[model samples]
Target: MTERIYTAGLVVIGDEILSGRTHDKNIAQVASWLQVQGIRLSEVRVVPDVIERIVEAVNALREGYDYLFTTGGIGPTHDDITVDAVAEALGVPVVVHPQARAILEKYYADKPGGLTEARLRMARVPEGAELIPNRMSGAPGIKLGNIHLMAGVPHITAGMLDALTGTLEGGAPLLSETVGCWTPESEVADILRQVEQAHAKCQIGSYPFFREGRVGANFVVRSTDEGDLKSCVDSLCDGLATAGFDFTPGGI
Candidate 1:
């Protein structure tokens, strides 16, 4: 039987992200982290900070994938609405988690704010959600069902991801090898299809680029099994060479 590969979806929530005021970086990092956990980042949607929009995105992604992650709109500011929206999506009332409040109280005891109302907002979560530790900031990430609510800040998100490492159940990590060629993709299209079709467990992706006034392409071969991955790469390289093209081991 084929192994079950876990998949995740991401909903990036913030008006700032949609407005391009803040360049979103959470997607790439989250994707990399999930990959380490053997889960594929299958889908991603960027939505404004509006509660209805957040609810829509959250419900859609969570229902389709094994896991769903949201970044942004979880801050202390007025526009912060991820928690509320997620609670709505789950059809649960928002409540201030006792442990979360206590954590915030302890975290802010010596800080200048001293766990003010604004800071306490971070302690609120969906009725049954749990906390995902945030070492960088006192405001912890929230976990409800398969949905994870994280920080918009890349560094903070990294910290949360570190805390979550090795906790999720997953299958094997995906592996890939890239072969770069100083030739057009069209020239090797048939070779790529032929090689990929011969390998049931492998996939090849073609990325074309123009540089130094020359057309070139990179073929990335991927598989969950290392041996199959290498075999596919070697076969692709052989095919390219037989077609009279000099290919680079790694993409340029």
Candidate 2:
């Protein structure tokens, strides 16, 4: 039997996001990254900055999934309660991690001035948590058990996620193949359905892309098993050929 690899879900916590003040970009990036590692995103929730709400989401997702990632609400502002709630959810106390503090001090201490208490807030981590290095800024994120706490800012969040993924143990990586057909989906819907049913283990998705006043569709087949993916693609191409639809085996 193939080993059961770990999977992760995301929790984006912030009043700004819930209020529509800021659009979230973390979920999509994180999803794509995890997909490359053969880890599926089972679920995602966007919650406000309320401590109870954050704690509840963290606890639920952490228990159900192999990993839980929370983005936003780790800033210095008063509304940044992600660290505190994560600690609460895990029954741990929040404390300034020495390594995280040192990272912060290195950057801020040399600036014409010195690090302040407000800036130091970024170094807080749940007890027994390991620090996830921030690739951009020195202020590291925190990882407590299976929960990864990251910054809300897109660049910083992306950096933290990169750092976390770099250190994680991964299973087989996902592979993808795309075939484009000029024919309308309605004309080829039946063939697509048959191919999908036959390749149940692979994700078969149809996306429409318009170019040069012509509408075309792309059928993507993705799977963690490379051999299975190629086999499914070959079968899909054969099915398309039998349907009399002109198709290309590769995508743009």
Stretches of candidate 1 off by over 4 Å are: none
TM-score of each: 0.96, 0.91
- All models: lDDT? 0.92, 0.84
lDDT of 2 by residue, 1-252 (tens): 875776888999988887887888998998988886667788999999899999888888999998888888888779888989988888889899888888888888778657788788988888998888888976778887778888888999888877766566667767789998886667777887888788877888898877878878999998877888998999989998987878988963
Clashes of each: 0, 0
Model 2 / residue 119 / CA error / Å: 1.3
Predicted structure 1: lDDT: 0.92
Cand. 2 Cα-lDDT: 0.84
Which candidate leads in lDDT?
1
The Cα RMSD in angstroms, rounded to one decimal, for candidate 2 relative to the true structure is 2.0
RMSD values for the candidates in order, in angstroms, are 1.3, 2.0
